[model samples]
Target: MRSFFDPRQLAHAPSREFHNGGWSAYAEVPARAEAILAAIGGTERPADHGETPIARVHAAAYLDYLKTAPARWLADGREGDVIGYTWPAVRRRPLRLDRIDALAGWYSIDAATPLTADSWTSAYWSVQSGLSALDAVLAGDRAAFALCRPPGHHAGADYCGGYCHLNTAAIVAQAARDGGVARVAILDIDYHHGNGTQDIFWTRGDVFYASIHADPATDYPFYWGHADEAGEGEGAGTTLNLPLAQGTTLAPFRAAQARALDAIAAFGVEIVVVSFGADTWEGDPISAFRLRTPDYAILAGDIAARGLPCVVLMEGGYAVSALGANVASFLDGF
Candidate 1:
């Protein structure tokens, strides 16, 4: 398997995120890949993987902005994290502007995701890590996990949201499709409903998206995960949302995983891209599900046994302190 990444991922380090009705210091801070290397006791260096040219799946200008706009933000006198504009400002402003800083609000879909001085570079590299893992797959590695930071799953084709900027899962799924896989299935096991993934693949039939998540009505993104929102047009019936009520423990989550795997199996997809996120861990600060550490191993084992070549893209898991162990354990099991 391959772990793809670019050095820029280290550039965007968020100080905190909103939770508990206020902001708390970040729990999952991304240490430098060098630190991860040292912690894992790896003498061998990870191979360099190039930055992913996001235009392969997203808009060209958007990709350009994602690569360069953060500099514009920093250049503007405003410093620190670049957050989204509030309601009236964003919804009301429709005019196109050349100022990259102004464009950040337009490009960013929501307030949760912020572009700091280094957001673009770090995010772009995280995407590169994912793409590199895919390239390794193309080279015949049976499985790979891209362990970069700034987890991406909520980003959309033309929009950024939910702490995600580039939509790595979508990019990889499409990469598989473009690489000649007739059908690619993205099984998002992230705690959130993956509203962006659902939206991206909703009108395309070739891609199948099945998600097991916290029910939208009761969870974070409240309008998109209903069982009835099944894909539209050619994508009709291709989207599956198995939203569980809060307080779901490992057993039920495993059953739901089985259901999703079965559906993907039924779809006969040649490739599987898992939008992996361990944020559902029982102790996670912001999530509602009750999965413990070992459960991730079980889920990984199940996915591996499904017998499809896979690329596991990290989505979200903010307990940075324990995140590495949980993620590495799951990958080892997978």
Candidate 2:
């Protein structure tokens, strides 16, 4: 299996994040990527696919904000990472706002994602890594992995949140469709639900999105990911969400995976995009799943047994010390 990783992804490190009504050290850090790289051995630097693929999923205004927010914050005589403190509750209307704070609020979904000077650079490269992996799969590789940090799955077409700035999985899926793949399926196995990914493809039938994550009723990103959110418009019945309870073990988790895989098979997709996250490991610091390191291999092997080309994109997993082993085990299955 070919794997891609860009060193520039580590440059987007932020000092801290706001969680549970308090400020704390950021759970998503550069060390997370380093650990994975150390375990995985060598990785190729991703080729630059430019901004066209990213723009296919993310909004132009949001991309501009990500690129310029840090400079704008500095120009306002502010220091540290730029974080949004206020957010609009109603529909946003056009307005002339020059303040960086206002722009932050306008473009952000929550305060967990902070914008640093190199965040845009890192995020841009992160997308390239996923695109590079997709390139490998499209070229006839059975599977490929993209080690993306500042893990994306929470960022939508126009907003950043959940320590995610850009929806890399969504972008790759769209790119697959644009590259002539008739049907694509995104299977997100992160501990947390991929709300942004679902939102981006909510009304599209070409790419089916499925996720098995902690129940939103008691976990992060508590709005989407319920079982009832099947899809809307042309995308109806294309989305499958299986919300597991906290402290879920492998038996039930495997059941959920079976259901998701069965649906994807039924959809008859030509390719499968696995939004793989090691946070579901039992030792993960910020997650609730109780899956052990060995369990990942078994779970991933199940997906591999489906005999489909796979493009695996890294997402959330904060147990720094155990992360590498968990990831390696997962890859071993494929």
Candidate 3:
């Protein structure tokens, strides 16, 4: 597998996060992509160093905002990273809000996704990483991996949340379609349902998105992730949601993959994107799932057996010390 990455991933470190009742360091690490790729023994590639730039998919206005928002925030008297404070912009209304802060909330779906002065640069690089992995498979790589950090899967076309800034998995799948595949599938195995991904592809039938996560009723993003939500418009019946109960074990997770695999098969895809998150493991600090380390390799091998070009995009894993090991083992298995 090929690993795609950019150096800017190190820029968006959160000073603190809510963990175990109090705030601890946000686990987005600088060395993760490189270390995980090295442990997996894969070829390394600089992200988005070619003719096609990485910012193409994002809205031009939002792209401009990300580029300048931090400076603007600083100019507005904020001293630290600007957390998207409140979302004032609603799709149905146009002339109701005018403040930039309001626009920030409007554009940002939730408070969890904050922006450092360097956030745009970091998110841009993350997108580059995803695009690079997509390009690798498009360039005929049998399979590839994007060792991107600041895990995205939570960010949608217009909303960012859940510690995610750019919906990397969706970008990769979209890139694959742009690169030539007619039918593409995204199998998100993150502990959280890929709300942004699901939302982005909810109305597009050409791309199928399936997620296995802790049920939203009992998990984060409680508003979405219900099995009954299915898909809308052309995407009806195209999206599959397998929301497992909390404390689900490895066997059940493995069993759940069958449903996802069935969805992938039904899509008749030539390319696949796997949103990989170690949070599902028993050791994760923020989650309650019970997957063990050994289960990772089996997961990798199982996905590898699908016989399509696959790109595994890193999502979330907060067990800092063991994080690299779990991810390394998965790629080694892949």
Candidate 4:
């Protein structure tokens, strides 16, 4: 498989992660991309396709905020990284707040993702990595891998959160549609549900979003991701969520994969973009699941058996030591 990445992805180094009622070393770090690249060699740099592709899924104002938020914070005399302190309880119309402090809360969905000076550069490259991989897959490759850092799948059209600034996988999926793909499916096997991806295509039937993750009744991104959130309006019956209980083993995981794959097959999608997250491993700190390292290969093989062209993009996987091996096993099996 051709792996796509940009070395500049390391620039979005976040320092703090809010967990267990206090601040800790951010689990989403630059070493993640480093380890994955080391395990899966021969990574290629992505082409420079500017904000056009990103705007297909994200809002222009949101992109502008990501690009300039750090400078705005610095100008405001903030000494540290820019983080969101609050969010509106009700969904309201845009206020177009120019203040950096208010805009931070306005654009950020949660407190976990902080913006550094180079975050925009890193996130821009992450989007390019996805587009490059998508181009390779559309050009006739069976599959391609995008090692995106500051892992996406969490950010929505108007907000950033969960260590994700831009929804790279969603951008690629939308780009596939723009590139003439009639039907596309996004399969997110992350430990946490891809709430942002679902939000992006919540009302569109052309792109189906399915996720297999820890049940949201007791997991991160505490809202959304329920089995009943089938899709809205024209997109009804297209979105599927297969949430598993804590400490779930491979047997149930594979069973859920079977359902997700069957739905994709039934949808008759031309291609699939997998939000592959290795955090399901037992040792992962932020997630709870009992999947073993070899189980990743088995799970990936199941997806491969569907025989659809795939654009595999990286997502959350915090067990740094075993993350490389797990990711390598999935790609090798695929």
Candidate 5:
């Protein structure tokens, strides 16, 4: 299978993240991509598809904030990477805020995702990697992988969080629609729910979103990813959330994947965009799933059984040591 990645993806290196009411080393680091590349052998650098394709899913203002916020923060005498402390949780009214702190809070969902100077560049190329992988699938490859770093699944149209700046899966699905795919389904097998991807297509019927992740009641991004939050209006029944328990094992995880695949088949999707995350590994530090390394092949083989063309975009997986083998196992299975 052809794979796409950019060296620039390593540039969005944030120093640390605020987690559990304390500051800690950033879990999402450039070494994550380095480990995957070393295991995957070679990858093609993606061409710059520019902001047009990204604009299909993300808001222009949000994009602008990601691009300029670093410079604005530095100009305002702020030190280190930009992290937001406040958010408009009450009545998020539309208003113009020029302060870097306010803009950071306005455009961010949490304090975990810090914005560095090269964040926009890396995030831009991350989307381009997915687009190029989609190009391969459109050109008749059975499947392709986008080794996107600074994993992007938790980002919404207007906010960035969960170590994600751009919603790569959402952008890729929208791009597939623009490329003439009649129906598309996104299967996010990440440890955490893809709240951003679900939010992006919640009211749209063109793309179907499905995810199997840790139950939001006890996991990160605790507000979204419930069983009852189905799509509304034209996208009704197009969204599926199969939130598993915290120490979930392969048997139940595999069953959830089968149900997600069956739902995709029923939706008549022509292509599947997998938001693959190896963080579900039993040894992962931040995540709490019990999936072992070999189990990835079994899970991936289930997706392969469907026979639909797939464009797999990288998502979260912080166990740097085992990330390579886990990713390799999934690709080998597919």
Candidate 6:
């Protein structure tokens, strides 16, 4: 499998993230990409597809805020990392905000993702990595891997959260749709629910999304990801959420994976984009699943055996020591 990555993804390293009632060293770090790259062997920097592909999925206003918020915050003489302090409690969205501070809060969904000076550049390249992998698969490669940093499964079309600035998986899925794939299914196996991808394709039937993750009742993003959220309008029955209980084991995890795969197959999707995350491992610092290193191979083999062109995009994984082996094992099995 050809892997796409960019070392520049290390530029927007966040020092801290709000967790467990206080701030702690961010779980998402630059070392993540480094470890994955080391284990995965040679990788090519993604071709520069620019912001257009990202804009296909994310809102322009959100992109503008993400791109300029860090520089504007520093220019205003703020201290430490640029983090959102408050978020609107109601569902009524704010139309516009001119102040940088208010804009930060308006565009952000939580305090976990902090913007640094290089955030935009890093996020830009992350999107490029996913896009380039999509390009490779479209160009006839059976499978490709995109090692995206600042994992993107959490960020919504208009909000950034959980260390994700742009929804890279959604971007790739959207790019696949635009590239003439009639039905594209995104399989997000991240530990957390891909609420952002769900939100983006909530009303569209063309792109199907299936995520197997910790139930929202006990997970980080405390909303969405419920089994009943089976899409809205035209997308009804297209979005599938297989939410697992906390401390889930490999047996049930595989069962849930089988169900998700069955649903994707029923959808008759032409391509599958997997939002792969190693955080589901038992030793991961931030998640509660008990998938072992070998379990990843089982998962990857199942996906590969489906006989479909696949694009695996990196999502979240923080067990730094074993992260490399987990990623390498999955690709090797694939």
Candidate 4 Cα misplacement greater than 4 A, ranges: none
Order of all candidates by lDDT, from best down to worst?
A: 5, 2, 4, 6, 3, 1
Write candidate 1's Cα lDDT for 1-334 as tens digits: 4455555676677676554466766544556344443333332223444444466667767677777666776777666676656433335645666765557766766666766667776777777777777777777888887765677778777677777878888888887777788999999988898988888889999999999999998887776788888998999989999999888998999999999999999998988888988788877777888888788888899999988888888777766566666676677767
lDDT of 2 by residue, 129-202 (tens): 99999999999999999998878899999999998999999999999999999999999999999999999999
**TM-score to native of every candidate shown:** 0.88, 0.98, 0.92, 0.99, 0.99, 0.98
2 or 6, greater by lDDT: 2
Candidate 4 structure quality by residue, lDDT tens digits, 1-334: 9999999999988788677688999899999888998899889999998889998888989888988999889999996789877788876786868889899998887888999999999999999999999999999999999999978999999899899999998999999999999999999999999989999999999999999999999998989799899998989988999999999999999999999999999999999999999999999989999999999999999999889999999999998998999999999888
lDDT tens digits by residue: candidate 6, 255-319: 89889999999999999999999999999999999999999999999989989899999999999
All-Cα superposition RMSD per candidate: 3.0, 0.9, 2.4, 0.8, 0.7, 1.0
Model 1 has an lDDT value of 0.75
Q: Is candidate 1 or candidate 3 better by TM-score?
A: 3
Candidate lDDT (C-alpha), each: 0.75, 0.94, 0.78, 0.92, 0.94, 0.90
Give the per-residue Cα lDDT of candidate 6 at 172: 94
State the lDDT of candidate 5 residue by residue for 179-258, as single tens digits: 89999999999999999999999998889999999999999999999999889999999999999998999999999999
Where does candidate 2 have its weakest 10-residue lDDT segment?
Answer: 89-98
For model 3, state the Cα shift of residue 165 in Å. 1.3
The lowest-lDDT stretch of 10 consecutive residues in candidate 1 is: 37-46
Using lDDT as the yardstick, the better of models 1 and 6 is 6
Clashes of each: 3, 0, 5, 0, 0, 0
Local error of candidate 3 at residue 291 (angstroms): 0.5
> Residue 235's C-alpha lDDT in candidate 2?
96
